[model samples]
Structure formats: structure tokens, C-alpha cells
Target: MKIVVKIGGKNIDFKNEDYFRVLAQLVKEGIRLALVHGGGPQITKFLEKEGRESQFVEGLRVTPPQDMEITEMVLSGLLNKMLVGIFHRQGIPACGISGRDGFLLEGEKYYPASGDRKVDLGRVGEVKKVNPRLVHVLWEGGFLPVISPIAADREGESLNVNADWAAARLAVALQADKLFLFSDVPGVLRDVEDRDSLIEVLSWAEIEILKEEGKIRGGMIPKIEMAEEALRGGVKEVFIGEGKEMENLPLFLAGGKMRGTKVVL
Candidate 1:
């Protein structure tokens, strides 16, 4: 099965050696994988170090010219290599790439609709196209493709693409069997503070109701929205949950018991 997994860039500990082992095992079982990762926390850290204040609009980072430079450096340079290294350590053949590579992802400047006005988010992009050729070739060659969320505009200008959205678009482009959004939380919760309130399965309509009730807020809002779009775009399924849940992904996809929230049509 082909799957796209987008790792959250928050408090996740990607260095967990066992996690890489789990991923390697899945690849060995003939599951083609594409990984997309975010670096929000890292970007903020670097921007602060350079005396630049990080800003956000509706959970998407506002990337000015200088901020775009820093973002590309951190996401494509630092985090991308780190993940590639992790896979290599597990004896897994992996190719690290940015959305700018081979025009894997093409986007344009984004202006988000906020209230009655369009908020001009500098250098933030909404994906306009996805080229899956490079990734498909790597997957067929038994190599995992790790992608960073840094994309380029038509004019070759760097733009920050939200990692979740990028993964969703890739899933559609690849016609992936499933898409997973790895997060710190277990899954979508009926009550934000209640761990036991996890919703194992949710529908698009239920998600809307939750949004109206203010149960889903902050960063999770856009992630879920992207997942819904992926579902409509032809992806068979989408899962959202903590990274630990991924350890049993192969089994989960095989119809075994797995813990997480599944978003369906």
C-alpha cells in the first residue's frame, strides 16, 4: 500500500530509534512511503536567534523575504537531512527532498480569508500543483522519500507551505491508500483537555460540528481541514494521532487493532 505520513514539527521526538525501526519494517513489508515534515518550532527558534519575530496567520506561518530564506534553510537543510540520517541508520534507502525539487510542489502566495477581508500572508503559499514523478521513482526503487514543506512560486521565490497541506496534496497526487498526520496528541478529542474523549472515527460533517462548538481550535483546525480535502481528492483514508501510534501502522493498515482517529467520508 502507498501512504503519506506528515510528521508534526512540535514537541515530537523523532530521535526515538524504535520509531525508525518500525518504519523500516513497514518498508520491508512492501509498503511504499512518503514522509513530509514540518519545522515550525525550529523555524521560530532560528528566527528568534536572528532577532526576527515569528508571526502566524490562522496557524500558517507568515514568511517575509528574510523569513522565507531562514525557513528554507531550516526545513530543507536541517530537518530534511536529520530525517534522512535517521532512515539511513536503520539501513533504509531514503531520498530527502524539498517541494522545490523537480517542482514536486508548486504554489502561489496565499491570502487567507479572515472575516470580511483577505489577510495577505507574506510568502505563505497555497499549493497549486504536485508532481509525483520523482517520489514515485524513489518508491519503486525501494527508497523512502522524505519531503520538507518548503515550496517555490512560479517566479522561483521561496514560500512556506503548511506541512499538513503538502502531505495531503501529495497523497492525492500519488493516489495513496492512506495519509497520516502525526501529532503530539492521541487524536481528535471531543473535549480538548480530556484524553479519554478521543474520537476513534470521525466524518466530515462531525468535524464541522466540532469546529462550530470550538472543540477543534488552533493548529489542529487546518490539519483536519486538509485531511477532509484529501479524502475528497481520492485518498482512501486519513489518520490523525500521536507518533507512537505509527509504530503499529503496518498492522493497522492490515486490519489489525490500532489506536488513532480515522477521518472518513
Candidate 2:
């Protein structure tokens, strides 16, 4: 079974051996999967060390040109290779790559919506086209790809892309059987302030109502939107859950209990 998994940077931990073991086990079972990772925490830490200020707009990082180098370095270099190393320790042969390599994720600069004008998120991009050639080649060679969400525009300039958006795009392009979005939150909640209000199952119609009622807002909107897009794009299933619950992959694919909100069409 082919699956696409996107992990939030906050949830990534060197101590989190359970997560890597789960993924390695999946690979051992012959389940083809690719990992797309975010490195927000690492990037912020690096920026602070470099005396560069970090900015955000609408929950998305405002990556100025100066910060772009650090962002790419942290996301595509350090974190990506680190994850690959961890997987290697588990006996999983992982190939670390960024969206820029082989034009894996190609797009244009993204100017987020502002009140009247577009907010310039310098060096940020949207994934317009996905070239899965390299991914397929790696898969054929029995290598699991661990990707960093760094896209390139038409001019071959590197642009930071959100990991969730990147994973969803890759899932669609690969026609993956399942798409998993790992978030800091446990799941989609009825009340953002209440962890117990996790919505176990959700539908597109319900999503609209939730948005109208303001139950879903901020960063989660993009995640939910990506889930919906993945579903609409022919992905058989889209799952959003707490980052730690990534261990539930086997159970989830086996139709067992999973602790997350499953998005459906």
C-alpha cells in the first residue's frame, strides 16, 4: 500500500523511537511510503542563533530572503538528513531529498492574502507541479524517501512550502492510497480550547459548517483543506491526528481503532 505521511517539525524528536520504529516496520512489511517533514522549530532556533528575526502571517512563516537560506539549510539539510539517519538506525534505507531536487515540487512564489494587498512571504512557494520521477526511482530501488518541503519556482529559485501542502500535493500526484497529516493537535476538535473535543470523523459538509461557525481556524484550516483536497484528488483516505499517534499506522491501515479525525468526502 502506498501512503504519504507529513510530520510536523514540533512533533519530531530524536527521543521518539516509537515513531521511527513504526515507520521502519511499515517499510519492512513492504508498504511503500514517503515522508514529508516540516522543520519550523529547527528553523526558528537556527534563525535565533543567527540573530535573524522570524515572522509569521496567518500562521505561515514570513520567510524573508535572508531567512530563506537558514530555512532551507534547516529543513532540507539538517532535519531531513537527521530523520534519514534515525530511519537508518532502524534498518530502513531512507533517501533524503528536498522539493528542489529534480524539480520534485515546482511552483511560483506565494503571496498570502492580506486586507487589500498580498502579504509577501519571501521565498515561500506553492506546489504547482510535482515531478515524481526521482521518487519512483527511489521506490523502485527499495528506498523510502524522506522529503523536505522546499520547492523551486520556474526560475529554479528555492522556495519554502508548507509540509502539509507539499505532502498533499505529492499524495495527489502519486495517487497514493492514503494520506496522513501529523499535527501537534490530537485531532480536529469541536472546541479548539478543549482537547477532549476531538472530532473522530469528519466530512466535507461538516468542514464547511465548522468553518462557518469558526470551529476551525488558523493553521488547522490549511491542514483540513489539504485533507479535503487529497480526498478529492482520488486519495482513498485522509487521516489527521496527533503526531505521536503516527504509531497507529498499522492499526489504521488494518481498519482498527485510530485516535484521530478521519476526513471523508
Estimate every model's Cα lDDT from 0 to 1: 0.88, 0.90
Off by over 4 Å in 2: none
Q: Candidate 1: RMSD over Cα atoms?
A: 1.3
How close to the true structure is residue 227 of candidate 1, measured as C-alpha lDDT?
90
Task: Give me the displacement of residue 148 in model 2, in angstroms.
Answer: 0.1
Tens-digit lDDT track of model 2 for 67-168: 999999999999999999999999899999999998799978988876889878888888999998889999999999999999998889999888989999
Best by lDDT: 2
> 6, model 1: CA deviation in Å?
0.8
Which consecutive 10 residues in model 1 have the weakest lDDT in total? 11-20
Model 2's alpha-carbon lDDT is 0.90
TM-score of each: 0.96, 0.96
Residue-level error in angstroms, candidate 1, position 74: 1.1
Residue 198, model 2, lDDT: 95
What is the total number of backbone clashes in candidate 2?
0
